[model samples]
Target: MRSLRLGMTAVLVGVASACSALGGDDTDPAADLAADLAAALSEHSLGDVPLGDEAQRTAFAELVAPLDEVPVVVDVVDVLEVEEEGRAEATLAWRWEVSDAAAWEYETTVALTQGGDGSTWVVAWSPDDLAPGLAEGETVGLRTLTPQRGDITGDGGAVLVTERPVLRYGLDKTKVEGTQVARSARRIARILDVDAAAYAERAEAMGAEAFVEAVVLREDDALDVLPAFRRVPGALAVRDTLPLAPTREFAATLLGRVGPATAEVVEESGGRIVAGDEVGLSGLQARYDEQLRGSPGTAVVARGADDVLRTLFEVPATDGADLVTTLSPDLQQRAEDALATLGAGAPAAALVAIRPSDGAVLATANGEGAAGADLAATGQYAPGSTFKVVSSLALLRSGLAVDDVVSCPATTVVDGRSFKNYDDYPSSALGDIPFVQAIAQSCNTALITNADRLDPSDLSAAAAALGLGVDHDLGFGVYFGQVPPAETETGAAADLIGQGTVLASPFAMATVASSVVEGRTVLPVLLPDHEVQQVAPQVPLTGREAGTLRGLMRAVVTTGSGRFLLDVPGEIGAKTGTAEYGEPGAAGDLPTHAWMIATRGDLAVAVFVETGVSGSQTAGPVLEAFLR
Candidate 1:
């Protein structure tokens, strides 16, 4: 018998020699030992290493079981340092691919003692040989942690959009009997104040056991009512926190909603968002999503099968920051209430209130059921007579005094197209009246007749003076207004009355009104913490121009279209607009876009009603309601 010490490399080199001596390769001991080691490492288990080895198998299994926990990928580097009748060494590399790419490479040395009979070698097995620093009872694991989302607050620290407790009432289709499912869905829908038929249709489409949410009500709102709902068959309730406003209709279009991230949003977020993560879906929430969603955390750990004991690596999650806004809950409620008074199926309407002193947007209320569009802040409609303020400023800059005599007529024609005053044009006001009285009466023909006094750029320049056409750097979507060059006399005549390619949002008109009171361009501010500011116009209103503009607007409220507010308590100044839109009717009367803008103290508001009959008749009452 010759003394033999063999390693994985030596076993391959001696295969032919050993095969000839033994007369067959199948019985070679080195080949058997090499096969055993390779198979054991590959399966992450101990084969027959020690003779009759029950203890060795148990210990090695414990260490390798953790690899499965973390799903470690292993690669054999090489085997070296084999000396006859001595020891051999093997190098192995392992990696947790879920975390990183680098592998942990280490060497395992095993001493081989030749059997006394000299035909075999026995491995001196130990649990530590499987991985460096790995103990007998250790295992690996992973934990994913998410950070808390940012809260959205309004003026005076009113939480406009924050996590609030709500009862999510729904039906689990699979839990209910087939005959009772529709009945149960309707019962739950009735309790939740949702459409019962819609809920039944939704429930029918879901797979068995699917949770079809009927409604989500505030915790306080449902607290007294939840018990009665719980008694309904197949009705299930789960309490969860959702980013919500005080009321369901409170600035819904402006604040938007937060829900599970969509596939498109997830892809756009790079690796920041995973499936099932909640993110802002619209309005300001969608605009400021990255800032609202904080960083996530990851950790790799090792523990016993029964207990968590150690952490190998960790990265802590960073919490999100708060988003403080300029909204006022009280004023927002009032704005919404005022818009609702127009009755159901009212044409699209909006009211926007701004603070002149600091340019903070106090309220933005779109009419109830505005078809999900942010009409209060983003809708594009003709400002109608509301645009007279810009024309007045342009007139004043051309040295026309508020007391300057400007003719007011029932109708005026320019470039073969007739522009007329609103229907039932007051016979008493159809004469040569002062400019201020012309504005008060919302004399459209008067402004149209005077279009030749200034260049087309003059109106745009005047509009820019009132923060209308210039970029304001507002963080959210807004159509300030647009004024193309009035190349033709007809185009200029239309521009004088805020028609023909001129469009403005309620928010933009509110800004225009505020600019007059502030004596400069007053840019609306929503996100105070955000660095963007409403860029000031190149040529803002002068102090004298602002004073004259304010005096003329006062005439509007005192004796013109906004005279409805004369009895109200506040010191109000206003301008009314009735822009003709759409094709002429059978009687050659065009539909009008009614508009009104008024200022009192630090507050300036703009109101609009598409398809309104007149500024005084349609938008005036809403303005009066808000002011009162």
Candidate 2:
């Protein structure tokens, strides 16, 4: 009886200890192994977990049995060759045929290490997605490839940016290579401002076969600083002709933009690269990309590991052709100055200047930020009083006398939409004003009241005649001024006042000024040699109407918003607009858009102050400085 009680006690103690081991919180070698197996078997729907021993496996099976509807299948398998720290790795692999014809395979890495008990445990496993080498009987290989860059130039064919020198660093990372290798690598990182551990680990992962880029530093900057890299025992420097650009934002819009090489270009060249091989994405560079890109010359050589030759490969590279644009430096500078003078009030304006004789675009300026691929020219906005110029021309063409009397009560409302003269000034519109005087003074009541006299279709046609709403191939982006609906006289009236759907680019307004100066329609162009043969009938303003509109425009420069821009000695004509439009219930006060269009001698100009209270005040000074 005593022996029987002792045996029973020993069995009870063994069972309790076994239960405790199964529930322990420390990472069980079995559980880790299970997770690793699952990752390797990801291609298969089911996964496997490691069991430390048959005893543990039995316990796990009993624990999972109640929850599983089907009997769980537990298998113990041994894998070879994978090592954690010089020991075999316990791993699992998956197989799933995507389709009968498609391939299905699993590849992965595993961790193996000997434990304190001298038993090897599978510590970890990588997913098949990140794994390698489970497919049957196939050879896979990879090669490094790089992009061919292109030369970037300025207005005068000045190669501000070019591909000059490329540097490659050779590193020896074998632990047997001595401590000097690691220490030297650390010094290189400190000098280059690169992460040291990252560089070291990359070397450890990729080894002697990898290449490190040293292309960012300029020729002078790199040459003067190369000594810092030379101290590394195994690191060697190689020069390669790579693409370079001098200016960061110098005419970024017109010149187009470039970026790093794409994978396809690298593959197409069979893993070899040509210097000065860049692709154009926008502006003249994009439009004439083919011509500018030019054909590549060939080079032949006995190569090194990289397939690049120390001297000329047999085929020399063909230089790309030069492209000349019509942009004028002096004019662009002047237009920019004009926008800045508009002040903080009008920070969202656009301006375009065009030469009527050749349709050459003198300059274009904007503050619309970026909308799609286009810049400011295509952005939407209210035209304000500047639009009234187009309306006045339409009315004059409709036989309304320039001297006709139009009584204005300082304020008028159309369709519950009320408007004030020039400003909310009561004194400005206290009395009767003449047709021409109304335009010169920019009287809202005078224009809006007379709005009914002009045909809606005629009004629409006139705006269209001025190129108000037309899509153009501007390379960047362009906006066409819009006409308000005519059904509502109120709508027509609003349109007459340069509000309600009317929007334009600084370039468009400049074209309008050019039309008046040349007595013919005009448009903006960026290239001197660009063709401009309009196939449609040219819209013409009657002689009397032209005379009247011209006189009013001239008066605006002499006495109104253009007063500040009178520095030009010759006859100059211009008009200004300050308009506002925003959601009815917005938080901060909405800004006003300021605008100014001027013509002097043969030169025509347009200016926009992004969001200024008054065009006359904001853009006038800028135009004056530029024209003078």
Candidate 3:
């Protein structure tokens, strides 16, 4: 035996990114903090080589006590290498770990030659460190690692995200000098949707020496989108998972994003991170980061500065758990389409559809033109006339008749505050409009007027019981709309018009529709089969009051603003609204919020088109189209 040693680096990971979520940035502007940390560790850590005394460990902590509170502190364990004998090379492992999270970990092995003891040290990419642990017999630790990922799934049990095999394509900075890497960065950027010019600048900034990760993709992955860079010189593409999700967006907000696992982060997890590890970023994945991120196995083999692969002791890889969602693809598409058409070209919009009879959101989607992903569920906006249903419920409960006269007005004062009808339409119609007509047409004056006479606290208590401005852990954001101020006339006016603080999501309006259909209050749920996973605290109105509100809502379809949808097949009830958003640069920038809430075929929904020109012209047709 020639006592042979070769430096071979192998990231033994053959799995796709599952729970991996991308952090804001890999190169954050925290270099000074890292430098100070590295300096403190150098001055105090490893003071006495082998820690034979119990006091030494505690003393080391004391030296870096100032830095410990800051969260990033570490010691230089060892500069590990693989020196081969007659073969001119050796095999070694470079282990890395993160001191935070204290629950996750990963490792990498390399085969290289002895460039003498301190000739050239291999500096890893971002988050990877150069420290090596004391080499125990037959076991050499390189870097610490961790991978954060969680379960994922689709409404119909379609597997969209899961752990699978992967092939890594890494670049050794030692072998390829400076310009030798520009082409790599350019090629990788084009492939990953990154800016090539920016990557080039960074590559140039790294100067002549330093390892940089240009790209990471599954093995044998085809460059389906960027065909120009396929099989280019100095390019490497290995075997990675066929982790496939049919839709590009794929409820991106809820399912989350994935990226590589870091060895430095694993020590914090008390786990291992192989190259195969990928963590989750948001929604379901983040909520279950621990359970979704499984412990990884290791194929420990030490290597030198060269680059070689060797096998020492190996632990078989482990797979992460699977997740299932309550998404209904077909319904979601239809709902999204309906909203887009109704928005009148507004940049942002959303639709939340649920089976009113139950509460399962059949399909939830944001329109293509929709601006900002506050998630329609979490977004707060003026409910406009759609909120009249609530005011009507209050009035009916307060012993008001459908035909009672309150004298409609173009502009009226309520509790000292002035309220105007839509576009300041005349107030004379008030005397004959009656309650049912006022509700059918979603009369703002009627609502504000009646709201004025009622107790503000009563509206608040009633709205609370109806699940307004409430939050729930449905794996999605849901904002409960605010009720108007009853104590003050201004609040009363704002409340009656669904303006002022009466902001809500499409989910809330749909709940109103559900309450009407189900004859009681209900929260919008995303559980399977529209099942009620959890009932948000709500105030259930009397069955009689609910029935009255339903009748008025039906009149909205029969002869009111939503009459255009009267021919909508099945027992469908709907209300149309054109809510005025504030002026430019003001909160809720859009000028009008066209709204239509309707139910048919077991579904209740709220459609919103921010700044839509007209409720009947815009949102009305959309509702009809969605149901058809």
Candidate 4:
């Protein structure tokens, strides 16, 4: 009986201790209510909390609805106080991710109250609980502030691309009656020379207050159509400025274009870019876009029903830095002018000029024939006899001298392939001639006959020494020419004259001319500050060898096909090339690509025409005009 009484007493004591641990009587109702409110706010849900009625809960949800577009996080920093009068205050920390680079953060005091029963807690609903100073009927939104785009500068700090005045022509629907909207749009499109029916349909489909843009033209071009545009009832012209070069075609392919960000750009930006933001689309503009497009500003604002806005937070925009290049404005204009002489409907052509002394790319010009292609820097073609410069170096390395007697037969045969000189090859210079005369005359058979003096790899090695075959990333699109080893005897014969398996761009040929003048491998540079890496050739070119090559090139201008450049002012060294391509034409002969490389004073220039009679006939005049 004693043991049973002791066990019963012990069981009663354990029950009392468990009840106390569970806060049976010492629990603070106000503190519990405050903690529940904090949890509800953090979860952005009030369904599990006893702090608000159904109507109050709905109001709280509506107040935070604008935050759905952004990421929001909330935490209770402190439960400041709980009063006997059923009132309390709690500090809530709010964070909103506005963009990838920006966030909005602040602390706001939330008021809590106990119901009249003193057992239930309710939140005092107010817009300030969501954001400080927010009022009823006001909504928060994010606004982007565009930063000024940077300019592209050339040699001597000359602005190559800057914001210039332009006129935006469009059809304003509200200015005209609904029946006349399409007709007015058609008239404006006709005047602008755009697709009239398409533009008319677009204008009809837009909202009543919409302005359907027709075209953006330079200020000077707008003058011719302004009088006609004003006659239309809804036609309007808005003045604006955009980054532009001196003319529409001024280095258009290399400089690239800028316009509103596309969906792909927005998606790829990871929140850094948004719709309606201007961005680079190609070439140097796209290559270095981030460096040229600075950080944009952002503003978090609350807009009221009356349309008034109050800023909650703001970040200032940072302007972009200028991009400086090695181009000379005057020289670039000259090269373009020279190519312009080809007139309309001419074959594709390209010209590239480099300063031999420093390897600065002075000009890169593509003729109208290129049709917006970057042929000067990236077009690959058979270099033709201009490759003789590289082949000549290989032969020179094999102990052949400029004065060495070599046979320049009218035609030569190699491994069942019959090779012949150009049809216009001079009869007097045929038969036995000095090696220098063979180069000056561009004799195909002469170089093919001497192919026995070199191994297959010798050509590529020589090409590398002259900056022809090796590739380098100079911060832009460029092909530095290629000289692969010939696989057969016929291929070797053709490779000796730059025909079989050899390819080069005008940019590469210009580097070849530059190396000859600079007395070493000259790698062209477009961006002055970009780090240029050099790939050492297996056999580096020596100053003495370059000097000898220069003299031989000069002989061409004096006595060979390049005599066309003789009248130009300064002493010039030049080589002319005519490479046959494709199947035989109706004339029983293949089409030829014209090529010419020349060095005068500090400038080394290369000109190429896709289909021409000969290098001296087609490319020589262009080179002379640029030199003059």
Candidate 5:
């Protein structure tokens, strides 16, 4: 039925005859009509086309309304004159860019008829002229098909983050009266242990048909609140699945979280992401979001008045690629367990373990006290006496041997700043001790007294050799510690004992221990396929120097502060550190950071506590638990 109704009319006209009547050049009427029709469809405008009446122009606008959301381009393919007088068929190339990843294209033909005066032509309108097989009751729409989000895997290809069942609790405004929306929101908020007033206010401000979400909980966790939630007038608990780890705190800080895409994420995506799409929000998940999210499929579908859909064009979705890491599940659990010994309300703490042979990070765990911060890899704190591992190397490079004599007094002063050893320093080992004895006992004054033997850059240079200050891009957030050159005489003396601006993370200190075990500067690796960009130090550590440093660290466990670790099954080398912070005369006692680093066989480990009395008493037990 070619009725040419105003609501769905298609109009095209030939301007060549009109131009000829105005004393213009020669032009084929069919070709001019085809050109005019292509411009009319592409711009969705009928003002320039010669239509029979205003009704036909309005119908042309209605016909293109369904395609307003997408970009459209039309080109005239050809025009053929039919046997019927003053009649022709025009073919058009149609293209619609639906999304950044998909497009729809097809060819359709329309009939052209000459007017009674035979000077202009108009297209016989119908729905098929817009799209082939597009019936009178049908309209076009686009559908996005979400791809499967990839899983995060650990050592031995053990799946870490995968699809798990959960329940979304929310206030369904459509189910209740407008006045009862706030009441239902408050009820659900109370059952979920959230702020009732805030939830009620939010629900009251939303549209009548909105679903104000209260919370999302794992299926097992929702068991207690399910009955109470159902009693609310508008409450709904929708069951769904999400990518999740085995436990809530398993690796929350490092693995990150996933949720609906925020406005910022959508705007930054340029066109790849849209509203309501699930996306990674932070940590490793955010860093590798594109690889894990994959590409979405699109379908250009037509729906009739009966609500039946027919796909006009489609592109299949591509599933995301799995992310492989070097982290070990068993070792990661053990590390978290060791940190649990700190008990509730403990200060921030972290533990990091690495394989010296291959530089693989086996575990990186932050205690509950860290409050979801990746402190193991990004925290920066003064290293204290544990940095003597690097200082020992600098002193050894300055012509001092293990058997060489060095002074270790109860107290020593440099440039009017007085320095003293730990409170429990052994009186028997105080004066004129061997260099090895000073290292094993962590004698601060002994290292400070030899400060003049080293240049301003000596500490920084040696720190680089031990992999403390060298930076590497490991495909995620990381801090490799920092050692700035000392400018003042007192600053130089302080830097030797790791007290003046020397800072390191647990991950960086673990690398230091690993370097000693590997007999070179060892760079840590997390992602299996990421190529690390290594930064070389001015003077790299040698095999002989690492061997000597290992023997000195071993003596600490054999006879010095780390004697508690002697009962552990393997041969261990360790260094303990206690660094003081805060004003000198402010409080009862200045707080100290506890730190410990150790190596056994191919494994190197570091443990740090934000505040403690001593490294041996505080962080040492945690390290021992992890080793066992």
Candidate 6:
């Protein structure tokens, strides 16, 4: 009986010890409640803590979820019994980092309730506990404020590209019947003058509710097309503004175009742009996109269930700067008109004009079928006999006089490769002739036979002096020609004739002609202050070299291939070129690229036609029109 009594005593003592460890009057219930709440808010997880009933806990967690996402730090200051039994009051300091623009801090009192066991306690939760003065049914949200994009201007402060009203018309696949998606896309494509079949396929591939854009037209241009879209089922149109030029084809290639930023562009932008922002696609618009796109502002806002919006903090957006270019609209229009006169179905062509004194690109235009391709400024083509100008400089520097005797043969072979004159080469002038006459006649044999007299560096250096085969940062898209090494005798012969990897763009050629007229390297400038300043030529043309080249070019106009320009006013000098390209033998019989370079008093121009038989017959007329 004594042993059993002792066992019972020990069992009671063990139970008391466990209970004291789990809960005791010495514990600060309010402090424990504050620690639990802070831990729960930090992890955004409620783990078996009873703020109220199960339903109440869920409701409280949902209410505080958004607030928990914000950076928060909490500290409990003190706790004291209130006037009511089993109820206590506690004070806490709540620190909230709202955003870069604002921060919030306040002291708030929370109501604590003791559990039925008296040792356990929990705060009577309310939205106000999270943030002082925050009421029920209110939530925080972040809003982005977009800024206005800037304008791209040209010379004389002419706005080249700006935010213009446009109608974005396309097919909404989800809104239309499954079978009607293709039909609707086709109709929209036809109305917009795009490829119908391609658009039909694109529409069928999109999501059911996706909007497949067909075309975006200027407000004025869309007026006539909008009436037709109404007849097509499932057709939808959104009126919006985009960066656009005066017309669809105005310097389309050099100025570029703007559209919804692509996934690639957005990814490249880091975090500056979201999914739906507009960005430049090509040309100058793309090159200076960041500068043209201004900084966006941010706003911290609060909203209620009734849809009332209250701004807690706001930052104003900054507008972008205006980009100015060195373009003359009048001359640009005239150049386009001259290209249009080439008639439809004409191969892609381009005309570039520059001011010889300042290297200002006055006018640039691509012909029919060349829009958006930048053929004038970026197209690389063989300069053909026009390259003889560079060869003339090299020969003059190599101790050959303008009146030096050079052989003009019907056919000359270099390294076992036979080179021939043009099919219409005057047979009477086939014998030995003055170097000047050979240049005027464009005698390929004369230059080919003399190729051994020059080295690859000799040609490269002279061409560099004329701005060919040299690199320049013009602030926009430009290919300043390329001169590959002519390691072999035959390669050197072809290089003398501007072939075998001698590539030149019309912009580069025009710069070369300008250099001769100015007696120095002409640096082309488009955008002021945005691009690298033009540097003086590393090896400028000497007065004697320029004078010699001028005399040779004038000979062509007075007695050679460019004789047609003799009657044109202010016609000082000119050179015509016809380059053979493609596979050798029968493939070479295809029409050659016609080219002409000319200089008037203050203007120097280069004209190119993709497939013309004769430079004098094809490019000469375009030059004449430009000069007139």
* Residues 466-555, model 1: lDDT tens digits: 999776567888788887678899988888888887889999999999999999988788888767655656677898889888998999
| Candidate 5: stretches off by over 4 Å | 1-31, 45-63, 84-87, 100-102, 114-120, 584-587
Candidate 1 residue-wise lDDT at 247:
84
Query: Which portions of model 2 show Cα errors greater than 4 Å?
Result: 1-249, 263-277, 303-317, 337-349, 366-376, 422-429, 472-477, 528-538, 542-547, 584-589
Each model's backbone clash number: 5, 45, 103, 0, 1, 1
Write the candidate numbers in order of decreasing lDDT.
Answer: 5, 4, 6, 1, 3, 2
Worst 10 residues of 1 by lDDT: 1-10
Taking the tens digit of each residue's C-alpha lDDT, what string does model 5 give over 1-628?
Answer: 3333322423343433443322124756666767887887888655476654557566657766766778889888766565456666677899888766767789987777788877678777666788889887677777888899999998889888988999999988899876788778888889999999999999999888988888999998899998888899989988899888887777778989899999999999997788999999998889999999889888878899999999888887888898888888888889999999989999999999999988999899999989989999999988889999999999999999999999999999998999999999889889999999999999999999999889889889999998998788899999999999999989888788878888999999999999999999998998979988788778989999999999999999998989999999999999999988775546577899999999999999999999988999999999999999
Give candidate 4 regions above 4 Å deviation. 1-63, 80-84, 135-137, 304-308
lDDT of 3 by residue, 114-176 (tens): 123422222221111222331212222222223323346655675556655554443334545
Sequence-dependent TM-score of model 6: 0.79
In the range 452-526, model 6's lDDT, one tens digit per residue, is 778668888888888887787778878989887787888889889887779999999998899899888778877
List residue ranges in candidate 6 displaced over 4 A.
1-135, 171-186, 193-212, 267-272, 304-308, 321-324, 368-372, 403-418, 425-434, 449-456, 473-477, 530-539, 566-572, 584-588
Residue pairs in clash, model 5: 6-59
What TM-score, computed on C-alpha atoms, does each candidate reach?
0.78, 0.60, 0.65, 0.89, 0.89, 0.79
Error of 4 at 385 (Å): 1.4
Query: Model 2, range 254-280, lDDT digits (tens) per residue?
Result: 556544435565465553323334565
The model with the greatest lDDT is 5
Off by over 4 Å in 3: 1-151, 154-193, 202-224, 235-239, 242-245, 261-276, 298-318, 339-345, 368-372, 415-417, 424-431, 527-539, 584-590
